[model samples]
Each structure stands twice: as structure tokens, then as C-alpha cells.
Target chain A: MKTIEIKHLWKEYGDNIVLEDLNLSVKAGEFVTLVGTSGCGKTTFLKLLLGIETVTRGKILLDDEPLVDEPDATRGIVFQRYSSFPHLNVVENVMLGEEFESSPLFGRSFGKKRQAIRERAIKILKRVGLGDAIDKYPSELSGGMQQRLAIAQALIKNPSILLLDEPFGALDPGIRADMHELILDIWKETKLTIFMITHDLKEGFHLGTRLLVFDKRRHDPDQPNRYGATITYDIPVEKTDNETLDEITGSMSNKKQEATL
Target chain B: MKRLINQHPRRIGKILLGLIPFLLILGVYSFASNERLEINPNDKLMPAFSTMADSMHRMMFEPSKRSGEYLFWTDTSSSLKRLGLGVAISAFISLVVGIFLGIIPKIRAGVAPLITAVSLIPPLAILPILFIIFGLGEVSKVMLIVLGITPFLIRDTQLRVMELPEEQIIKAQTLGANSWQVITRVVLPQILPKLIDALRLSLGSAWLFLIAAEAISSTSGLGYRIFLVRRYLSMDVILPYVVWIAILAFAADYLLRRLSRSAFPWQITATREAK
Candidate 1:
């Protein structure tokens, strides 16, 4: 069964079309990674899925039900920057989802329910390797630690789908590797349907069960913005070995390769 | 030692450097007062420090002979009450209005121009209008303060809200926060420190309106006392009142700074790193 399905989706801003006639179906518990060059509509696709940007045409279905125009608890997102509230500490940040769920008006819960929420938040933080830094603020944490807190914040609500937009883009290589392992472990444990966008082809190939490449196949010299980018390459990596992946990459690049990526 | 001083001045040296300007002003004032006294022993202008001190003691400690009320304390309490009421009301109103204007594009488009136009009007020019409408009472004075500062506060808060990263708002919503919940939980907490900063900046203008309104008409206030003593050339009372006003303003600013540091420690850390 598909967890998310997009049919004939089109996104445009004024005369500029960013995504055109795109269709995607993501099954439950699939780790999907998208790779593209800058301004190739990769981030726009994520925004459309997160409901931050509305589609110009067509519909998106979540668990066979039409998704609403606004964001909901079923979908969680982590951005490259500003992934966590700087004012809240690690524990408070992780607990924020449950707090909002319990008391939508006050953004807080009280009594025994609040204690349970805190304990859950702490357990999640521990899983994310942030138990010692629960009392620290985002500004006090290193870049890697902050990303971990953000992941905990997103995962605490047990969202069915997690969207990450270049979440490890700012971390060092060592930290990025650690984050990759952490994210993979989480995906394995929770069986979440995750959609991640990355500029690094190796990272995209290494993590995801399915890989999607976005690029504008048809280009006109006179009217550059006439057509939007579509998914030019969709490679299933779950069953393909490293040698087979190279053979697939060679054939895919020959079919519709763009100069940028 | 010289190299060390050039690289970074010691704490004691920095303190002495800061005090130099104050000491210079004091010395120049004392010299001017002595010169004036030599010409006229009964001179009311630039009264001696001792003379000013005596007047302060009388106004602050002793009750009025006719009314049996400590004028200084009564004036302070009344002025503080008006100032506090005006600031608190305007802050609450501006917060609600500013957030709405910032988050909702339609409301922002409709009301932003009106607020900008109102803010452009010099608050002092409306002093007579406020007095005539609200009458020569505490209401008028407090209203004047609110009118003077609310627009600026609203604009500041709106800008702060707009400057927030779009990702944060989206993240909040995806985390199951409805519109109101996103505002209260995410937007409100982020902008509170900024609001305190806006209030701190508005206090200067708030004091200006308060004194101007009080000078026009008021039964009891620090501004009223200052203007009352001005006609008699009571330099002793006037100078002391000016110094007292300065002290009060400093205390208020200090208290606000301390409050922001304690209430929002994360903001402080962020600012420190930014610096």
C-alpha cells in the first residue's frame, strides 16, 4: 500500500513553472532520497509535499485520503537551518509536539500527563544520543547535536512520514557520517516513510531504497522557463548491488543527462 | 605594561575612563555655580549642591505644610502609575494587532498603511487634541503616552514576526500546531525577547509624552512639580527633579535589561554569539 501518492502535480509561481506533471508513489516504510542540482525543483517538491507551497494543479493523497492544504501532524519536516526553536532546550523542544497535541491552546500540559510527556521526550532524546544535553539550548549545542535534537523533535510525535531538506548540509564529514547512521537506524526502527533531498549523489545512493533525480528534460533557448522539471531518473536501489548500480547509472545518464547534475 | 594597555585596557582603567566625563561635567558646573554666587549671593540659577540637597530633603521627606502630603512621593507614584498603565495596555494591544498584521497578508495589506500614516503624525501636535477630548485628567496623560508609543511598538513587533524564518512556522504547523497554537507556542516565544527590546526603546518616547502631558495639566506628578517650581526660578528644586528623573529612567532601563536576561536566557546566548 502506498503511504503517499502524487498525481499530475504542477507547481508554478507567476509565469515561471517549477514542477510540471509530476507523479510519484511512495509505499509504506520506504526511504526515498531525491538528488538534483540547485534550482532543479527538488526543494520545491519537498515544500509541496509538506504543504508549505500549494500545488497549482492535481492532488496529493496521504494513506489514500486527499491531503489538506495545510500541514498536519502526519508529516514532519527538518530543514537545513532553523530546525529547532532556539528558545527551547533539548527536552522542551522534543516535548513540544506532544505538548501541542495535548493542549493545543496553551502549548503545554499539566500534572501527570505532563510528566509522561517529559519522560517520552527524554527517552527519544536518549535514543538520538542527546540525553546529556537535554537542559542545553540550541545555541549552546554544536551543529551535529542541534540536528539530533531536531530529529528527536520531529520523531517524538511518531509521524508516519518524515521529510528532510538537506538536514546534514551544514555538518562536517565526521558528523554527517554519524548523522547518516543515526537516520538509517531510526528509519529501520520506526519503519517510517522518509523523503530526503541531498546534493551529494553518494549519500543519496548510500541511504535511500529508491532514488529520484529531478531535471528539466525539455529546454528551449527562446523560452527557458516554459517547461518545469520532472523526475528524469527513478532508480530502485533496494535490490541492486554496487556493480549493478554503476551499470544503471551509466544507462540512466545516457538517456537524459543534464549539464548541472 | 604599555603593550598590555594598548592590547586591552584593565578593568580599573576602563572604569576610570568612563568616570572622566562625569567628573569633568561636575567640575565645570561647580565652577560656574561659584562664579555666579560671587556676583549674586541670592542667585537662584545654578544653586549650590548643598542648597539643592536641602530642597530635595524637604520635598522627599517632609509633608506639605498646607495639604499634609509628601509632594515628592505623591508625584512619583502618580507618574509611575500613569506610565505603567499606558505601557502595559499598549503592549498588550500591539502584540495582538502586530501578530495578526504580520501573519495574515490580507490584514497586513489593509491596516499597515493606516498605522504608518498615524505614526507619521507628531505625537506632541496631538497633545491638545487628546487633552480636549479626554479632558485634563489622568486619562489624557495616559492616553497621550499610549498614542505616542503604540504605533512604533506595533511596527517593531510586526517586523520581528516577519523576519522569522519560514521554516520555523512550517515546522510548527507540521508538528500538529494549529494556527493559534503555532502563534502561541512558536511565534510568541520567539518574539517575546524582541518585544521587551522594543519596549525598552519606546520608554524614552513614553517619558517624553508623559512629561509633556503632565506639564500641560496635572494635579500631581514629577513633571507638574518641575513646571510649578520653574515660574519661581527655584533652581534648587528644578535641578534636583531633573537629576531624580534621570535616576528613575536609568533604574527602569536596568530593570528591563535584567528581566530580559533572566526571562530569555537563550536569546542572551544567541546575542552573545552573534556579537
Candidate 2:
């Protein structure tokens, strides 16, 4: 069975359709990256996969079952902002998911259970190279370190699907390169089914096994929100030659500029 | 010459600079008091510093002849107890109600405007109603303080919760947190420091309500004593009692500030964000 399958999915906010005619099916342990111009419903698609937003039509099946209406532990997410809990230290932040799962009422663990959670959290933090900063608050960590903490927070839950939205867009070039290596390493180690959205075309081709390029195939100037974006190009990134990759990406960017103008 | 924008005074300079206004006020008070006393030896509007100090000493240290209680301590204690109880109850109610109102759209839609309407109705305007309902006693006085500050605290707390980033709640849910768990784990901890701050802001109004209620009807309190001495123009006793009230209020506020600082160290630190 496919790990995730979407069929004829459409999302609309009243008359404004944000995504339309989307169809995809993916086996487990595949790295899928999405790239599109701004305001093209890419983030909205991530939100839909996250189950925070409801679909207007069609269905998403996760492992042969319809997707749940809300977010849950089976899917983990990392946003550009990280969304780290300011009050909690690094270790506490990472293991909070487990705390919520095990102790549903208080979202806290005590005694031996608490200790077990702590051990698990610390082990994961060390894996992410945050061993020395376990007790430090999120404010004290640098940008790169905080992103690592965010990754650890997601990884602690052992989610089947990891959704990342522009995870490295804010980082400097040096840090972004380091992040690429780290994410690739994690994908190999865990065999996670990752769906990440990025603005950069080169980064998409370099990281994703399958690169899905989103664009609007239809538009009405009279009714600006009449048509939403759809996947225009689905490239098997590894099999594509460098010249073809450059040509496709270049044409897409030109369209992007024209649309913006 | 140092530019004012970048200039920060050293600690000693800060202390010395802080004292200048207080010294000037003292000098002016003494000058005005001596001038009035010289002109009319019986004048009571501005009592001499020594005379006021002596009255304060007697009011605080010595037991009253009729009641056999040190009036200053008893007055201070009674007022503080009422203020403490009222504020504690208001804070608890504010926290629970505010959080509910903030997270749940239905509850907020139904109740927020009612709270706003209640807050706008002057608490003092309803003092007579409270006295009529609860009677002129400790209950009425305490109720006044509660009714006065709870609305503002509730509103402040609700706004703080609503102000929290939407991402945090979604993140919690993605980690398998239910609605109740989201409130307990994510919403509660983040709103606490702000609640303490709201309490600090509301304390001044709490004290105002307390003293007003006591002034209107009470046997023993700082407010009662001050109004009691007003008939004879007993400035010496009244001035000391006033100063004593100010000191007590300042102490309570200062303690809360310290508590908020040490208990939630993260609030005072820099923002927790990545580039």
C-alpha cells in the first residue's frame, strides 16, 4: 500500500480556490520536495497534508485509511519559525509530544515515567548535536542550533511522515549547506517519508528524489481567484540531466517573474 | 560631551540622581511647614517633621487605650488581608475564565462583551448596591475590591492568550495533544508571566477600591483611620497614616515584581526566536 495517496483533491476558500485537481500516490521512504512561486498554494498544500486545513473535495488516504481531520503524532512538522515553546528548555521542548501522548490530562510526567521521557529526549538531542545545550532555553540558542532543536523535537515522535515548510530559507548559506547534509543523513538513517517545500529550485533538485513543480495552468483576470495552482511538472530528479534541469527551472522562474509583474 | 541617546548613568550616579527629587520635596515640605508654624503655632495643615514622626511612633508602637490593639499594625493587617483575598480570588477566576474565553471561540463570543460591559459600569457607583445587598461589613468591602479589578485582569489575560502565536497550538496538536492537553501544556505556561504582570498592573486599582470601601464603612483599617482623623484636621496623624499606606502598597508591588522576575526568568530575558 502507498504510504500517502491523494485523489482529485481540491481546496477552496469560498470563491477563491487555492489548490485544484491534485493527484499523487507515494510509497514509503521517499523524499518529495515541492517548489513554486510565492502565493501558489504550496504552503496551503503542506497545511492540508498536516490536516490543519480541511479539503473542499476528494480525499487523502494514509495507509489505506482516510486522513484524520486534525493533526496527530503520525505526522510531524517543522515550520520556518520552529514554533519552540519559549518557557520550556531544550530537553523539555523535545519530549513534550511524548508527555502529551502518555499523560493526556496534565501533559506532564512524574517520577520514573518522567525520568524515562527525559532519557529518551536527551538521547535524541545528542543525536542532533544538542547534547551540551539540554538545559538552555530556546532564546539562548543560535539560529542553526535552534533549527536543529526543532528537528529533534519532530524526530522524537518517530513520525511516519515529516512535513517541512521552508525549513532553511532564513539561514545563511553556510548554515543552509550544513542543514542539507544533516537532513539527508536523517532521511537515510530513519527512512522517513519527507515532503518539504522550498523556494529555491536548485535546492529542490539536489535534495528531493521527486521534485513537484506547482504552477497555475488556468487563470481569469476578471475573477482573480477563479483558478488555483496545480502540479505542472513532476520530475524524477535523479534521472534528469543537468541541462534539462536548468532549462525547466529557468523557464519556471521566467513564468514566475511574468506572473508577479 | 556625552550624547543622551547612548549615555547611561553608572549605578552610583543613578542612586544620587534618584535622591535629588526626594530631597527637594523634603526641603519644600519642611520650609512650608516651618513658615506656617511660625505664623500660627496652632496650624495643623502642615505639621512639623518632628511632630509627624512622634505621632507615627505612637500610632505604630503603642497600643490604643480603648481597643488594646496597636492600631497601626491592626489597620495595616486588616486592609492587607482584604486586598490579598480579593486579588487572589480575582486572579484565580481571571486565569480560568480568561483562558477559556481565549481558546474557545464560542465562549468568547458569548461572554467577552458582557465582561466589557461589566468593567465599564463603575464599581464605586454600585457601592451602595453592594452595601444594600451584602450589608455594611467586611464582606462588602472585600466584594468591592473583587468586583473592581477582576474584569480588567480577565480582559488582560484573555488578550495575552489570544496574542500568542497560532503556530504553537498547531504544533502541540501535531505532537498528539488533544484540546485539553493544548490548554494545559501550551497555553497555560506561556500566559503565566503575563498574568503576573497583569496582577501588578491591577494592584493599584485594588488598593483604591479597598480604601474607598473602608472609608465609607469600617471600624479599623488604614482608610478608616485617615478619614476618622479628618474631622479634627489632625494632619500629624493623618499624614503619618497616609505615608504608611503608601509604603505598604509599594512593598506589595515590589514583592510581586521580584516574584515575577525570579519565578519566570525567561520573561525578562531577550526574545526566543531564530533568524
Candidate 3:
């Protein structure tokens, strides 16, 4: 079964329809990247996958089962800004997801469970090259380091599908490149299914095995909320240079127009 | 030594020299006034000074009585101890409540009016009702102190939580943090400095509530001591308690400032540069 499947999904906020009749499927361990201009509903799709936003119509399935109301360890998410807990050091932030792994009901603190969670967290931090920073507070680290910590936090549980909503969008080009490579390496090593939303077209092609391009029609200058925006194309990212990738994207857009007509 | 001297050579030298005589003059003036200003034996001024002298003497000479002894007039030391306990407990409680309420928008929105109403109720108004329920015991006093102080903590913390750099929240969430993880890890840390500040502000309220506590019920607190002295037209004893309250409040505030500095070193640098 596909790791994630979306069928006729639609999302709306107030009178605005964000995603209308969206259908897509991500195969097991496939790297799926979503790229679009601002307010193209890439973020909304990621949020929907994470179960943060509700669908107006249709359904999202994880491993052929419908995604539940609350997010579990089966699906992990990473946001654009580094949301490493300032109060908690890197280790604690990473271990936070472990609580969800054991049970949905909170407040079961066991020694074995705690140790297991800690080990998993440390392992993830090491994988992300943040083992040394496990004890450091988020404020003590640089932006890149904090983002890495955030990645570790999402990676700790080894979820079947990882949802990233512009995790490297805020970093400088150099750091962003490094993060992109790190994520690519991690995805290769773990073979984890990924659904990353990004605005950078180059980054999207490099990272995503399949790229989902959102439509210009979905964006409104007056009311711009990406979580409630319509998405359009679900294009496979062919291994090619920047010029070739753009041509592919253009072809995909034309196909969408034909389908709509 | 040479490097240090060069860094602040002329400024330090001038300031040190200038302060010597100014300090001496101030001390001499204070001592001279104490000796020369003779009020009528029956006048309120003489008794006030006597009370001040007694408190100073007790603080200097009687260390054990500060904690061990309990008397109607002897409350400065006890008041100091109780105030310390109140602050510690209130701070702990405030941190727990502040973080919980601050993170949950629904809870904050739901309880906003109730918290506001409770906060607006004067500490004095609650004293009688608290006394009736809890009696003239430590329970009522401590309860009043918490009620007086926690609302400010909640409001201040909620504001801090709201003001948290949106960048951090968006970043963490993108990283796959659930709501609890975000609250404890990101939001709580950033909001801590402001919360500590709120707690420090609440300290002054704690002392005020403590006095109110003594005033309404207790036979042996600084407030009660002052009330007792006022009855006898003994302004001297009353003055000491007043001075004692000021000193205690100052000391509490100063200690909290130091604590805040150690806990939030960033804020210390922030304030030092601002000054």
C-alpha cells in the first residue's frame, strides 16, 4: 500500500476554497516535495498530512488507513522556522514525540520508557550532527543548529512519513544547502517517506523524487493564508538540470490547464 | 593591575575621591540629628525613634529571636521569614499556572474575565471571608497572598506567551512538534524572563498581602504590631515596624533582582546596556 494517499481532498476557510478536489498518492519510502509560489497551498497540504488542518471534503490515508484527528508517531512534521523548545535542550525536544509513540493518553512516565525515548532522541541528534548540542538550549545555538535540532526532534521517532513545511526556507543559502544535503542523506539512509513543502524550486527538484506544483489561481493577494490555499499539480521530479526542470514544470502546468478545460 | 587602571583610571579615581566626604557628611548629619533633635517625652516623635532604635538593636544583637521567638511586638524577623516562604510558594505556583494557562488559548480566553474579577477584588475585601473559612491561621494568610499575586503572573505570562517570537513557533511546528512539545520547549523558555519579572512584581504584592494578613487577623505580625502601638499613641514602636516593612520590601525586591539576574543572564546584560 502507498504510505500516504489523498483522494478528492478539499479545504476551505470561511468562503475561500483552498484545495479543491486534490488527489495524490505517495509510495512507501518515496521522497515527495511540494513547491509553489507564495500562498499556493503547499503548506496547507503539509498541514493536512500532519492532521493540523481539516479537509472540507474527501480523505487522507496513511498506509491505506484514514489519518486520525491527532498526529501520532507514524507521521512527523518539520516547520520552516526552527521550533526547538527554548526551555528544553535539544535532547528533550527530540524526546517529546516519544510520549505520543507509547500512547495517546499523556502522563505515563516509566523509567524504561524514559530511557528508551532518551536513547532514541540522542541517536536522532547524532544522525543530524547535533549530538554535541543535545544539552544546549535553543537560544544558545545558531539558526542552523536550531533548525537541525528541530529536524532531530521530528526524526527521533522514525516515523513512516515525514512532513516538512519549508524547514530550510529561513536559513541562509549556504546553511540551507547544507540542510538540504543532510535531509537528502537522511532520507537515503532511512528510506523514510517524505512530503516536504518548499518555495525554492531548485531545492524541491533536488530533494523530492516527485514534486507537487500548486496553481496560481489558488492565490489571492487580498486574503493570503497558505494553510487554506488551493493546490494544482502532482508532477514527478525527473533527474535533470534547472532548465530541464522548469520545462517539465511548465509542461505539467499545461497538462493541468487541459485537464481543467 | 596596569591594564585595569588604564581602562578606568581617571573616572574611577575622581568618583572615589568625590564620594568620601559626601558619605562622611551624610553619616555625620544623620548621627547629629539623632542626638540633637529632642522631642517632648510625651510627643509622638520620641517614641517613633525609640521603636526604630529597638528594631535596629534587635536585628543586630538578637539573631535567634528572628526565627525562634514569637512576641506581640516582635514581628520584623517573623514577617521576613513568612514573606520569603510566600514568595517561594507563589513563584512555584505561578510558574505552573502561568505556563499552562498561557499556552492554552481556550483556557485563557475562558478564564480571562474570572481572573480579572478575582484580581480586581481588593486584598482587604477577601481577608474577612478568608478568615471566616480558614480562620485566623497561616492558611488564610497564605491563600490571600497567592490570590493577590497569581493573577498578575497569569496576565504577564499570557502576554509573554503571546509575544514569543512567531519565528520560533513556526519553525518548531515545521519541525513536527506537537502542541505540548512546543509549549514546554519553545514557548516556556522564551517567556521565562518575563515570568520572572512578573514574579518579582508580585513580590511587592506578597509583602502588601502579608501586612494585610497581619492587620486583619494575626496578633503578632509587623502589621498587628503597628496597629497595637498606634493604640497606645506609641509612634516609636509603630515607626520601627514601618521602617521594618520598607527595609523588608527593599531587601525582598533586591534579592529577587539578584535571582532574576542569575536565572536570566541575558536580561541582566540587556538592562545593564539600557542603563
Candidates' chain B TM-scores in the order shown? 0.95, 0.96, 0.75
Worst 10 residues of 1 chain B by lDDT: B1-10
Residue A248 deviation, candidate 2, in Å? Answer: 3.8
Off by over 4 Å in 1: A238-261, B1-6
Candidate 2 chain B: worst-modelled 10 consecutive residues by lDDT? B266-275
Clashes of 1: 0
Report the C-alpha lDDT of model 1 over B1-275, residue by residue, as the tens digit: 46765787579999999999999999999999999999999999988999998998999899999799999999999999999999998899899989888887899999999999999999999989988998998899999999999999999999999998888888888788888888888888888889888999999999999998999899889999999889999999988888888899888889988998898889977777668
Writing each residue's lDDT as its tens digit, candidate 2 over A25-85 gives: 8879999999988888999999999998999998899998999888888888888884788
> lDDT tens string, model 3, B1-275?
46765765478798998899978975775565465555443445444344567755664466535465535335666676667677677777767666777677788778777877877888777778889998988788878887788777777777777676564665455444567766755666567677667876777778888887887677577877777667777655565567667877777678767876787654543444338
- Show where candidate 3 strays beyond 4 Å: A99-121, A218-229, A239-261, B1-55, B58-73, B81-100, B103-112, B136-139, B157-196, B231-240, B254-275
Clashing pairs in 2: none
Give the per-residue lDDT digits (tens) of candidate 2, residues B1-275. Answer: 77889899899999999999999999999999999999999999999999998988888899999988998899989999999999999999999999999998999999999999999999999999999999998989999999999999999999999998887888887888998998988889888878888998899999899999999999999999999989999999998787788888888889988988888876554443332
**Candidate 3 TM-score restricted to chain A:** 0.82
Every model's DockQ: 0.76, 0.69, 0.20
Please tell me the interface RMSD, in Å, for model 3.
5.3
Candidate 1, pairs of clashing residues: none
